[model samples]
Target: MMTSKIIEYANNLIKLTDEEAEQLSNAFKEVNIKKRQFIVQPNFTAKNRYYVLKGTLMAYVVTDEGHNHTITFAIDDWWITDYNSYIFQQPATMFIVALEDTIVLQIDHEKEHDLKKSNHKFETFFRIMAERGLASHQRRIISNLTQSAEERYENYASKYPQIVQRVPQYALASYLGMTTEFLSRIRNKRVAKKS
Candidate 1:
């Protein structure tokens, strides 16, 4: 039942034969995490990629200065992993924590490799997912480099209203590369403009 959501997600991207669907379903196992629980932490190998079934998760890193920099957030139908660690089979530099009580379907690195080897469709599906993730990261990098803080905040809020509404203000501020107080001021300005 947890796998059903993943099957539907895959099917939306590429037509899956009945057998491929069954294979994919079997490859992923369900996991439940409590709020604030960490699914991946620094120095541990990130062996699985998770597909969110419900609730929210955030991936972030703590700097030497003790600042937490949010890398990304995942909600229902989204995938979350430290791709660098997962793909390279190296220890993770990030922490992936559940922002809310969460359920996810996860595929281990070995199992995913086996699935891709077993079918071209599986390989294609993963490749497409990777490409899209890469594009999103590149876009974020460009935006951070070129946009003003207010422009960045406005663009991200407009594009991902759900994330803006669901995530804690501090976490969202970190993700947008702004301080929490600055974000609060920006938000107040927006509210005043609307009023």
Candidate 2:
């Protein structure tokens, strides 16, 4: 069961009553995703929110030209989903992919609503979670607009070291708005200088 982990994560972010926590756990199901697997994809609707229990994942969009741009990365204790698609019942514009063989706790929309109805605190939890997502999105936009490629890479390396190791260099390069060749050059420079 997800009782312990849910309580732990919820307590860190938002407090939940005992009964509310139980209900929240009941709504969750453990799921495993293989590396490079798509958890959510464009043109399809997302019905669940996933909390990373192990390993890492990325949510991204791919252009018609086959260029991919990653939008978000989730690691242990982090949540991911195409919220707009899940909440509005529309097609997803992004795809969420497992960066490594991973495990996640998933809660579908219906179960989430049922849990929300059981307590105001639970509803508040989701509201806060959404707000955090918005804030993260805004921060990413500002960084992309103002930071240099090297600066962005450094920011990610410091902030999400686990992601740096679990995700492919190509995917990380796309997210940083740099070509794989440039990213490789930077990585090589770092390694050579360290040695």
Candidate 3:
């Protein structure tokens, strides 16, 4: 079911015949990444977009202050890339790394272009992903600007419970733009509320 994850993702936006699914899946090359490995580094061009088949990958950047900020994470059935760099063929300012030993299906620019040209459904699927990414980023910006820390954490927990389980708390805290100690307090408050 290596392809099943992507096939299912594709079908969510646009229904495809089995034959089309197979064709779309064929564009990917399987890659295995070791824990702590860097997939794409700052100042390098990101060659491919990866679909997570198992384990996790993170996209992050180190600030001038020498602190890492988590930009995004991808788990099973999710997509991960230094997206702006990949799309525009520019050098990446972010890093993409394997958080755990991982399996992924990767597609290069040529293959992606070919796949999209071959199937309108593929084009629609990617368009939807782009639109959703934009919407999610907008919501996150609004949440950070307006929501209290507790409210933000609760909203994220409800929306992406799987991320809370799969990612380290410190990384999640960074992604939430909070201190780890603050996140710890939030977690404690959440536990107290549940009880």
Number of clashing pairs per prediction, in order: 0, 0, 0
Q: Per-residue lDDT tens digits of candidate 3, residues 1-195?
A: 687778888888899998998998889888999999999998999989999999999889999999999998999888888888899989999998898999999999788988889878899889998899899889989999999888889999999999898889989999999999999999998899989
Ranking by TM-score: 1, 3, 2
lDDT of 2 by residue, 87-136 (tens): 99789999998888989999998888887897887888899899988898
lDDT of 3: 0.90
Q: After superposition, which runs of candidate 3 have C-alpha atoms over 4 Å from their true positions?
A: none
lDDT of the candidates, in the order given: 0.96, 0.87, 0.90
- Report the candidate with higher lDDT, 1 versus 3: 1
Candidate 1, residue 167: Cα displacement in angstroms equals 0.8
Error of 2 at 193 (Å): 3.4
Candidate 2 colliding pairs:
none
Candidate number of the best lDDT? 1
Q: Give lDDT tens digits, candidate 1, residues 72-173.
A: 999988999999999999999999999999999999999999999999999999999999999999999999999999999999999999989999999999
